[model samples]
Target: MSNDDINARRREQVELNMLTVAAVAGWYIDTYLDKKSCRDSALSGAAYVNELLIGHLERFRQVCRMERPIFMKLCNVIRSKNLLCDTRDITLEEQLIMFLFTIGHNAVNRQVQERFQHSGETISRHFNGVLQAILSLSTQYIRDPSINVPIEIANDTRFYPFFKDCIGAIDGTHIPVFVESHKQAPYRNRHGLLSQNIMAACTFDLKFIHIQAGWEGSASDAIVLRAAEKDGFKVPRGKYYLVDAGYGNTPNYIAPYRGVRYHLREFARGSIGPQDAKELFNLRHSSLRNAIERVFGVIKNRFPILKNTSSHSFDTVTDEDINEPDDDYNTDERRREGNRMREAIANAMCDEYSIHTRRLRDRHGH
Candidate 1:
């Protein structure tokens, strides 16, 4: 009698467990069927493009980090080049817009999907597609400056005669980058943050002429400059570029005097005037080179995501990366010549600076 009763009770418990499992499974299936797709919304990708087509200029710029006309021009370029085409449901403009919105805000695929009312896969496809198209056009837009003297130096009294041969400013900035734990050591800068060392050559008007990106954060400015030269970034013969002390003081790549107050801050806020010609030269040099710093600031202000770029994992190297053979430059002889040239320039600047100082003191009755 005891065995029979135990066996019957065990069977009843098993049957009850099976019924509970079935009930839970049925609930999950019903919930899945009732749930709405994340992409189901009123403002579709096409609809958003149409709104932007008729929207205010400032509003479009605020959303895309570029003017609407520039945005349209980019779309036209990609389309004219046959790099991108209108999908059945989305136009070429919408495709480029999705990519721009994603990068402009550093929005991830999911965020973009929500904004454009499309599946994550769809958003990712167009984003990468537009990215490729833009990369293909880099050579067309980014180029070396013409051999002529830029107006910023040609027209300004402070720089005119001395910097008449100066073409632009060269500087390096660090941008956050993601890499594998083992690969992160190279990207870890002295500040203990993982970043990429991006070298920029820009005109005084805050326009980038040449950009060499994707270097490790720990990479030195000199190394990046060498790499850039190998990749065909040229400083015209007899002309030079203004750089900070981090770069080599070599021919056609002039750098500030090391161990001197070269940054603008050293001269601002009622700071003492330059003690000598070398100091004076550094002060003015830094002032002109400050254009590159301003360009970096402007870029970050326009795209705030650049300040903290944790949303996207930029771990891959694209075809746009330069892998050219090293260009033998910055040799000892070249550097020594560059130093002599710098000393001459500094000495030449002293007479003008003294004359300007005399005029200022006389005007102030000092």
Candidate 2:
């Protein structure tokens, strides 16, 4: 073998060896990726459904914020309405679970993706799909106030006739929000936090009758209420809604007298009872209107997402089955008669004020 021939043969051998190594490495990398993709798909498919079934019932309720029966009923409703259909990899139940879990926990898309072992895109897509489905059911779930008074209000003598025509309480709450710089000015409330002013009306039973959201935080409550009115927020000619002093005292809306101790806390803390007719009216008004505040409390407690707003733009509507009133509320003339009855009761209460105070003191062991 000549020196030149030997050198060429050795170089060719080295080239062949390098080519073989490269081919093997390529095949290994492709196989690893394929395996990873399949594993992820499998995890995503089973994570929500399997966990919901095999885990504790309380765990399911904790994640979805409803009992198992209620959750299943909601799923059936969505299915029957044709609001959501199963995809190749994700079922309707899984999609609903993911949606509720995300909202109930105020989780971001990435967090949901990790929990379900799905891609970020998949998480985003299904979350939006379920949200739209829920929105479609709003009309059916959010009902109109009945013509009769709720038992909670009717049973309370202080609120009965005074608030008989009052369908519900209306208020504007600041819900924290996130927006771009250009939009932040409008969204920033008086406290200088980015928020959206949401106007909601709830009955004495803590059921929402109307919800108007997406208003700028800087907007006043009255402005939002007026906007809602234009957008089909109607009050029957004889009925009214209780509102705070932020709203005007129109015939359709009743507001507490300004410069009065209207909060229930003040009355509970041994504050003086109504000193005059206006004060008496306000005291009764406050007592009835506080139901709306309690409704807000219940909702925020049930859905923590309201406390900590999510970046994703979504609206929430909570509807629990409530019994309807058996009969129509008192008529306008009867309500006026109720007003006279209230005045007499107030006088009697005033006459027995010392005894009531003594009882209060005795109860407190003071």
Candidate 3:
């Protein structure tokens, strides 16, 4: 159909659906808007959505550098599916919304093609733009400008109560992604599916401070931690991230020992042996570490698409479903092939981290 015809139909559709859209927009504002400062309910909400959506789209273009054709392709799918735009005719506002929706959904070329009947190249173009937007937004949102601690935390918490400076909580999460070829093994998880090992950090307030997506699942949590430590991430000095058993105890990072409950969990469980006092220390570390769990929960909550399997052309999510080989490889050929496949597949993953001291050093400006 001609673009004009599509625009005419979309106008009618928007008119019909406007009330519901406004209601949803209201909810969006209520959930995300700053309540104390935003005095005008209706205007403030609308402005917030507009700024966020526009900023998302603009940022996407900067990061992805997508071409027009690809951008159009992605927009078509988002509009057709009623994702954000809800109309075929793309206004600047609708386009912005589409970009935000695409990033939050992690929708890629093939998925867009399948859902919107657009070509792969178009989706690719648009995908880059959306990716760029995500990168920019993530960087923008993942920082804490005020290095100082807030007053409430100083009184309420024992750790860093005086300075209100807890560096952050760290954790690794698996994101389902697809891969091509036998190289997918490394990304495969214990459940026998392909997945990306993503590592992230959040402030004491449960705000996401740093996110490193695109890691292979085969790598240990320690590995992810080590990698991030090298990345010059803003992990403050004299403060430590709360970590689980996956990481090793270091000056900057603290992890609970294996087989012991953290803090109160351990108190109910048993006293520490003299030989295991250090072990008990580790357990106490975990009690503080659990905060990352809630941060991850909130991230997933904000972006429901993170919970949905990636249905991109790369089928990164599909590879996450691959079955692990039944037996461990004893033969040279089997071992070689397995390791080769793991390395090859690992590169395809977005990233990996291991509990390497060198990597940690690099990340910490050593």
Best prediction by lDDT: 1
* Per-prediction TM-score: 0.85, 0.75, 0.52
TM-score of 3: 0.52
Model 3 residue 48 distance off true place after TM-score fit, in angstroms: 20
What would the per-residue lDDT of candidate 2 be over residues 1-366, giving only the tens digit for each residue?
Answer: 999999999999999999999999887766543323533555554666777867899998888887888888988999998999989778898888888888788888767767787766677788888988988898899988986877876787666655677788998898787676776787889988878888899887888999877787798887777666766778886777888998756666777767877777776777676666567677777877888888888777777778776676523332222222223333476545544544554555444555666799999999
For candidate 3, write residues 1-366 as lDDT tens digits: 999999999999998799889988897666445322323244332354345445666564433344334565755654564544332422534335344455456655444344433344444544454455444445545685345663434554333332244466788888766676577988887777777788888766677777665667787776665555555565555555556656644434544445654555556555643223334344334445567787788667645557656656444222222222223213456435433432332232212222344489889999
User: Lowest-lDDT window of 10 residues in candidate 1?
Assistant: 316-325
Candidate 3 error regions (>4 Å): 1-89, 99-124, 144-153, 157-165, 263-287, 313-366
**Local distance difference test, candidate 1:** 0.82
lDDT of 3 at 122: 41
Candidates by lDDT, descending order: 1, 2, 3
Cα deviation in Å at residue 165, candidate 1? Answer: 0.8
For model 1, how does the per-residue alpha-carbon lDDT over 1-366 read when each residue is reduced to its tens digit? 699999999999999999999999887765454333656788777888899889998889878889988888887888789999998778998888887787678787778878887776577677778877887898898777877878888888878788888889999988887687878888899999988888899999888899888888888888888888887787778999999887889878889898888777877857788989889899989889899999999998776666765555564323336454465667799999999988988988998888888999999999
Off by over 4 Å in 2: 1-45, 313-366
